[model samples]
Target: MIACGLLLLCFSRKQYVGKVLVALGFILLVISSYEGISGRILRSLESQYSPINLSQVMAPGGSATIQDSVKWIVVLTSGIAGDATLPYQLQVSHHSRVRLIEGIRLHRMLPGSKIILTGGTGFDGSPEATTMSRVAEELGVSRADMVLEVESRDTKDHPLY
Candidate 1:
């Protein structure tokens, strides 16, 4: 949209139409990029799935009150900034950070649960799983309890790994 707007603005005979297209394109971009709006849009799509009853599956003192078979919490990461100069938390995207935190929370609730972090070397050549593992360590998760799958480049490749 932005590209089309720029092209119209540069070569189109009608300058006013080009200006309107450019303005509309910027507006659409802002609407889509805003967190509150985008988050609500995502939530609407996710509303079909019912939330889990954590109370039924989890118990106090890092033990399950019920016979909960679920153990591994696989964290399928989107992408990381992968900047070596930055801290581990800073290198992860917001979605990855949230997923990691939730995975750690669930791990704490389940005594023997493990977190499987997945992602390959992203744009900056740093492994996303390694970055998440470091952050998880700082957050008090044991390295022994974490599994890193750093060969999957994207979500589609995760099942294969």
Candidate 2:
């Protein structure tokens, strides 16, 4: 749109306006692509989360122990691969896998807490929660300890369900 507008302005003999628009667009493009600026924005958002102390949660024997009031470890699905030929564990996306792993870690640290996995069938045609459940099961999380809220297609739907 900016390019088309600039071209139209140039053809209309408004060279000054066209040049200014082109310069402004170039500056915006450069600013948007700058890694340092984007990285700082991401870091600022991530900093809102409280830091986790794994040493306090994991016992000397490498088992997780609970001492918190958390009753539910909710894991929101990130994404999934649609390929049915692959194993269920391999079907989860990298981001989703990381989230599931963190959820599992927290679950292990909270004894008697239940895991609530939420996601519906996305564009890829598989329910993310189902795939996450399979991975959690493979990691030794009992079936009774997990709940599948599989009707949620997005975060907005999660709270409603």
Q: Give lDDT for model 1.
A: 0.86
Model 2 per-residue lDDT tens digits across residues 1-161: 36955895868777777877888888888897899988898889999997778677767876665555557888898888888888988888898898898989778776878999999987677688988899999999999999999899889998877
Q: What is the C-alpha RMSD of each candidate to the true structure, in Å?
A: 3.4, 4.1
- Estimate, for each residue in 1-161, the C-alpha lDDT of model 1 and write its tens digit: 66777888898876777788889999998889999999999999899897667887866654587645877889988778856788888888899999999899878777788899999988888788988999999999989999999999889999899
Name model 2 segments beyond 4 Å from true. Answer: 1-35, 52-68
Model 1 lDDT-worst window of ten:
59-68
Candidate achieving the largest lDDT: 1
The per-model lDDT (C-alpha) reads 0.86, 0.84
